[model samples]
Target: MLQASFGSQHPSSDARKVADWALRSHDNRQAAFIIIDKRAARLYVLDEAGRLRGSTSVLLGAAHGDDTVPGIGQRAISEVRPGERTTPAGRFLAERGHNGRGEDVVWVDYDAGVSIHRVLTSNPGERRLARLASPVLADKRISYGCINVPVAFYETYIRPMFARQPAMVYVLPEVKSVDEVFAMAASPQR
Candidate 1:
């Protein structure tokens, strides 16, 4: 039940950079999410909105490769890879839940079985899961194919975004053309 107001000012270095860019570019009138490919990361938050509020970073699926499933769109690096690791590109939704640590998380259910939850750091192997780890996990990639945000950010901004129900989480391969992806997502699934 943590609110967005709690950590509105303490965005991560990456999140702060994205917010600054977005605010200057968009004038903070709309809500936006940024995907950082080179870093295999993502940022979610409400724009300026007359005041800064809510933010978090996520581990993405692997970059494109031969093992990527075609028609499923570009794979993000943080997604599960059968036995490796990978994330997928396309539109998605963020639900809510608690991780093993019992921290509130935004459950981004994208590719089947893939979800973004709080960093679950209970063991050694789990620690090396992703590049970004909290003081707790410090090294685990627990997601199957979804983005994971720190508990603090998730509760502050993400939770409220979905309060109205059905919040959209768009995943693009890069900053390239998103028309095709959006069009396909809007069209009925055949």
Candidate 2:
């Protein structure tokens, strides 16, 4: 709507609604915005004016859901159950920061300890990288509620936009209705 071009058409109406609403309503339209489609296992990046910068496959939580345990973020991974591993759906004001491992990441839900980082290829059994490359998005769910993307994509697009300025993130809901998770007035029909 701002004379900018959008690249991916994969985001559902819910995701697109939230992104559009943010661009039109949020005061800081100059900053970057991101939309993560959990159902699609895709990440969409856009400029402040709503033009798509790039998009790529991503890995999400192993389980499917839109809510996280109240204090699961602080618990050790070993103690967390499989079903509890979920990426919450909502709007997040993401910022860039370094994790304990000294690797750069974009914290989407800080309180939930959810962040977007380069895909980890250390665990060959998990086949994380292979999952991301799979044509079926359902294969991409193998992380611990964190979003894992390609290293080049993160360094090239995500880090630059979020490292300097805060960005908006909309994680589309998979188990709940968009209205239930994000009550923003949806974009008007074309």
Candidate 3:
């Protein structure tokens, strides 16, 4: 069996609960796994054995919710209505790739145009870096649906996490309980 260890500082209360269950489960244990806590605006990267590899703040969708809007990915960021933006909460077999912009990223839910990549600096007006460095999670919610992360953090942690294989990404729900999103992954025998 794989061993486990905690690497990041204490996670949010809700994150702790879901992580507790994830720790007990074995389904996603053989591969690198990531836990995106939208409510806390944090992402925790864990190793194949469930040991915490790294953790960093992340920028999520502008709207607060657990589901992604259908067809939102086809439209321009300006065309998407406010509520349509969401970093859907669920499991994803995320893989690495180069976006149309030629930037390397890990697509969490490609159909929804949701991917985790370095903070977008193309639009300085977005003030993405400032938002990510802010002392509050509220300011971090500015993306359409993608999870924006610091370049250093993305390179140092995220990229390496999925370097060898496709990692499982678990985006914890903000609108729903952890039990709801991770019900199947959380087996009692775990």
TM-score for candidate 1: 0.51
- Lowest summed lDDT over 10 consecutive residues: which window, candidate 1? 181-190
**Clashing residue pairs found in predicted model 2:** none
105: Cα error in model 3, Å: 0.9
lDDT (C-alpha, whole model) for all candidates: 0.45, 0.82, 0.82
Tell how far residue 147 is off in model 2, in angstroms.
0.2
Per-residue lDDT over 1-190 for candidate 3, one digit per residue giving the tens place of the 0 to 100 score: 3344565477776666655556566656567788888988988887766778888889999999999888877877789988888999987889998887998899999888999999998889989899998979799899888999899999899888877788778898988987777775444221
TM-score per prediction, in order, is 0.51, 0.91, 0.88
In each prediction, how many residue pairs overlap at the backbone (N, C-alpha, C within less than 3 A)? 22, 0, 0
Candidate 3 collision pairs: none
Q: Write candidate 2's Cα lDDT for 63-170 as tens digits.
A: 899998899878888888889889888878789987768988999877778999999998899998789899987798888899999999998999898866887788
Which consecutive 10 residues in model 3 have the weakest lDDT in total?
181-190
